[model samples]
Target: MTRPLLDVRDLRVTFHIRREGDLPWTQPRELHAVGGVDFSLAPGETLGVVGESGCGKSTLARALIGLVPAEGQAEWIDGKDLIGLSPRQMMKYRNDIQMVFQDPLASLNPRMTVGQIIAEPLTTHHPGLKRAEVKERVKAMMEKVGLLPNQINRYPHEFSGGQCQRIGIARALIVEPKLIICDEPVSALDVSIQAQVINLLIRLQRELGLALIFIAHDLSVVKHISDRVMVLYLGRVMEIASSDDLYAAPQHPYTQALLSAVPVPDPAHDMAASVVPLAGDLPSPLAPPSGCVFRTRCPRATERCAAEVPVLSGAGHQTACHFPGPLTEAEIAFARRTEAA
Candidate 1:
């Protein structure tokens, strides 16, 4: 197999949770924000990460870009481990990987002009670039992201949500990063604007050959842009498969439930179609369930699910379930019947 541009292996992130009135000041409580996760992204490919809220998708993205402290291996480009990099080395590595945060209004600096915001990365990374050159580069980037060059002088507040996100994308792309970790980029925008932003991402990716890890809760939104999809639950990956295979025939029970919830467009056909809501709320990450993180909500879960954790195994498609497979015809018929009544 060809070497991928980005390789993440057993990536885990933990945070210290302190109560208002805890016992000893020296003692600290640990919360596992991200459980072990493994995935890869080829050069110019997009891997969509989908899950419910607080499922650690954003935390994983932050860890990949080194914005947050993480344990486990995140090897980028030529097998360089991000976890071991020093502050100075990490500073230099920042130019190669960037992130587009969820909230555009909060991600941008209110005080900085659009030009300065975009040029800041270049000026810091490539100090040799003169003032005129920096300005020219920023203008070019603004244009690349569909923003007018004149708007370079404006602040983020002057633009709409979509326009502000464009500025954010310009800032990330201006550095010419090899990989971009997009954390729910369009969830904040209206449904109409979401399509526009998604389309813009697809166009830019094809043109620039940018490797992407798009994190989103909406499975259908990511389906349009991603090559492969990874379904996560309670900080653990439930399934990983090609977009064609996963959506057409989901394996894991959790994945099945998620896909079942997406409303089909046509009402006349598949008139019995309806969403299947998962049984219960996602368990707390601080103290995740004993074995399978999704067992509490998975319909097919058994005693084995509560005892031994299932390891991901498959050739092209992997699912972390002992009895993972596509739903049978009878099962589909039953689900439709249940939804109707």
Candidate 2:
């Protein structure tokens, strides 16, 4: 096997929030945005992160790139821990890790021309390079990401949403980062545009040999572009497995429900019959369930699930569920008929 490019363990990101009208002395509530997520990425591999809106998919990505204050180890293959790095300290590794944010237009500065935006990273990292060299590289990157060299002088507002995203891709790639964390890169695009961006990313990964952490709510897109898919609930991983394995035989109840919600393209397929209904809203992270964060909504959850936390175990396909395996037929039926408590 090729050596892993990045290995992360026990990664956690917590935020302290003080509500309105609270006394100065009142203790702030701790919101665990990411609770011990662990994963590894090989060179040129894509790991898709899928979950509900509040799950820590974005947090995990931010934690990896030092955008958020995180705890635990995110060891780069070069023998550096990414967590807790100061801004100056992180500058050294900025070229090795880059992020493409969800809002393409917002991520790009409207005041700056496309050339300047794409060339910004190069200027930051390779400050000694002459302006001419930076412009040539920027134009080359723009062409690579499907933008015309002549349009480099145009501002972000001049382009359509999809074109703006291509510009964002160019900026991220301009630095030639080894790993690119795409936080819902395609979610904001039109459905047709989403496919274009996704294909662009896949091609870029292939040509550039880049590893990607693709976080999105669209499972079908994730399945298409990812070698492995990880399912998160609240702030913890529910299942992590190969795209084919996890989608084919989802072991965790939460994973099963999530997969079931993916719309089947076939017109004749009974979408309603295939769905595994989940109960209740996601529990607030401030006071998550003690044992299993997913237990409150999982039909298969039992007494043991509520008392003891399940460790993510298994060789090839890891799942953090006390009863890890495919949901039985009866359980699916029960979940479908059950209403929120």
Candidate 3:
């Protein structure tokens, strides 16, 4: 068994935000963004985090890299805790971890040339590198990510969306980071272009032995790339399992609902398919629903769900539910009665 490159436990993130009508002296309320999330990543492994918006997907990713202030253990491979590091302290790990943001154009600097954008990390992290060394390394990386070396002088706006993303990938890889947190990196590209970027990440991970935390709402894309998938709902994990297990037989009701929603290609199948549509809105994180955060929307939720929080408990296929397995329609109806009660 391989040791994890990064191990996270009971991770939580909160933001102090002021409401619109609040007075100046009124206390800022805590928006509970991430709540007691836990997972680990072996070196070179990809962990895909999927959930609807405001499920704390982005918050969890940023917390791992120390971009956002977080609490709880984010134990690195070397046993260093990544939880409470000051900005100065976290800088040491910046070279070892990097991020590729969701927006390709917005993430890159329009003012800086592509070469400078790629070289900036190397120059900042490894200050003693000679100008020629940085330039040569940038050129090598540019070629590696399928961008022509000559295009190094071009600004970000000069390139297409896909090309811009390639530039972003080059920038993240130039530092030779061990783990890269990709926050919906290809979401903005065309469907065909998304495939290209995904394949590029796959190839690079294999080549460099890099670990990845790929965050996106696209379950199909996540299934294609991830070794393990974690299902989050309003800051808490509903389930975690191998991509094969998750897609083949989802254990949690929330997970099953999500899987049911993925579009099937065949028109005949699409016509006959049944979606397990969840009934309620995503509960507010500012004041999350008590007990199981997902209970309100889960089709199989019951009295136990409201009274007691279900911890993730399983060997390989984990789920936070009292009845964690395949669900029947009758059971779903029973849950609805509980909701009405």
Per-residue lDDT value at 43 in model 2: 82
lDDT of 1 by residue, 35-65 (tens): 9999888999899999999999999988887
Residue runs of model 1 more than 4 Å from their true location after superposition: 25-27, 269-273, 328-341
Give per-residue CA lDDT, model 2, range 1-341, as digits (tens). Answer: 76688989999999999999999999999999999998888888999999999999998988888878999998888878888888998898889998999998999998999999999999999989999999999999999989999998999999999999999999999989999999999999999999999999999999999999999999999999999999999989999999999989999989988988899899999998888889778989999998999999888888998899999999879999999877899998888778533
lDDT of 1 at 328: 60
Candidate 1, residue 87: lDDT:
76
Kindly list the per-residue Cα lDDT of model 3 for residues 1-341, writing each as its tens digit: 77899999999998999989999999899988999998988999999999999999999988888878988999899898988988788888899999999999999988999999999999999999999999999999999999999988999999999999999999999999999999999889999999999999999999999999999999999999999999999999999999999999999988987887899897778522356666768988988877898888777667988989999999889999888888798766655565456
RMSD of each: 2.4, 1.1, 2.2
Error of 3 at 216 (Å): 0.8
Q: Which ten residues in a row have the lowest lDDT in candidate 2?
A: 332-341
- C-alpha lDDT values of all predictions: 0.86, 0.92, 0.90
Clashing pairs in 1: none
Best by TM-score: 2
Candidate 3 positional error at 272, Å: 6.3
TM-score order, best first, reads 2, 3, 1
Query: Would you list the clashing residue pairs of candidate 2?
Result: none
